[model samples]
Target: MDHVVVEPDSSSFSRVARALDDEASGEQWRAELATDLHAALELGVATVRGSLMGMATGGLDDGHEPLRQAVSASVESQVRMSGRGAGARIRARKITLRNFVNAPKRLNSRRGWRHPVHGDTETWVTQIGAPGWFDDPLRRLHARLHSAAARALDNRARRIARRG
Candidate 1:
């Protein structure tokens, strides 16, 4: 029999090995951590939504449409928070939203592998602050959304483990 040894370099095989290590140490602990992290994230999201909604309502006068416009403007401002000029603003909004939805799905699908606990946590934390903000409210909202999404994903992972 011939044996071939290969080094891990961001490959699926190494990923499986890492997961096995996590499971061997304690799957339950991992699951609990994931749950806690998820809850924190969800809380962040709610906070952001609340802040945005409050801002909209507080600014609204006799016209109800202004509230809707305010919400839209707030979100648009966050999306366009980056980029060079007008064109960059338009592109940034589309790209940011698209990535926001897609990135979570991609991370969630990785439940098949074992991830480093701290590594995953750091990723979520970094995501919350990924977008720089001139407006405090928008910055908070972005951070909250990121945290919430991450928490939701951790919850899903826990559910999956429970099923198995």
Candidate 2:
């Protein structure tokens, strides 16, 4: 797999971090970053799981269970680390892992729930409900995380381009 290296001098990191922080207050930013990181981590896990399922079903004929397992484990480990970030720290530690695991299931179950603003393409799942400090804050945080990650990745690409 090819990984993009971000130049230390690039403003993209700070820009993304600042944008995230500005979009939400300092406290909210932290929470959203954590939530987003958790979501990204789960996405990575789901990709691994999908790959494993594919291999099991003979969709991938190369017999890559070990590879898939390694990838999944790595993602899970990262998820655990990211879960310790700002927003996550605010929530109870014991439930963090459970929430991370359940996030995907919740998303999957809400496939039919259309987004009010964006129609069917943009949907949200509030499996844990929307009344608590943790719930809405985490949702917003996850959204910010997703945007920041994309920005970071784009910044990395731009850096690589400059180098090349």
Candidate 3:
């Protein structure tokens, strides 16, 4: 894959983090950076997460899946969903992900999710160091988990294969 390198937008994370720091001082603890981080995370890493979700449930539904494939030609999703980001460690999520799609790719030195806000796409690296942690690990884990889930559901896969 031809990896695109996108320089991080300098002010995005800081702005969000600063907003969190300023607005979240009360005892309710309902609002905090961690919570903010959780919500903000999906924006940047949706692609990676979506991809994992697809792989994990590969055979579950033929009708549809999340982020179902890579290199999708249609505006509709190409990759499938699974579940997988944040932080300038708050700016990157703020700026680039405005129109971000969860197409995570390993960049040089930094693992990246492509930033697609502007016309020309740029692959901005995530603050989270590991790019596709949910990626290969999920693929490996899914093979095991999917089999296990199938067994739990009465070993249907083998039966289906044997029937075929």
Instruction: Output the number of the TM-score-best candidate.
Output: 1
Model number with the top lDDT: 2
Tell me the tens digit of each residue's lDDT in model 1 across 35-101: 5544544444344444444431222244334432333343321121125741111111222231233
Greater TM-score among 1 and 2 belongs to 1
Q: How many clashing residue pairs, candidate 2?
A: 2
Q: What TM-score would every model get versus the actual structure?
A: 0.25, 0.24, 0.23
Q: Which residue pairs come into collision in candidate 2?
A: 31-87, 32-141
Better of 2 and 3 by TM-score: 2
Q: Arrange candidates by lDDT, highest first: which order?
A: 2, 1, 3
Q: How well does candidate 2 match the true structure in TM-score terms? A: 0.24
Total clashes, candidate 3? Answer: 23
**Candidate 2, 44: how far from true, in Å?**
2.4
Per-model CA lDDT versus the true structure: 0.39, 0.40, 0.35
Better of 1 and 3 by TM-score: 1
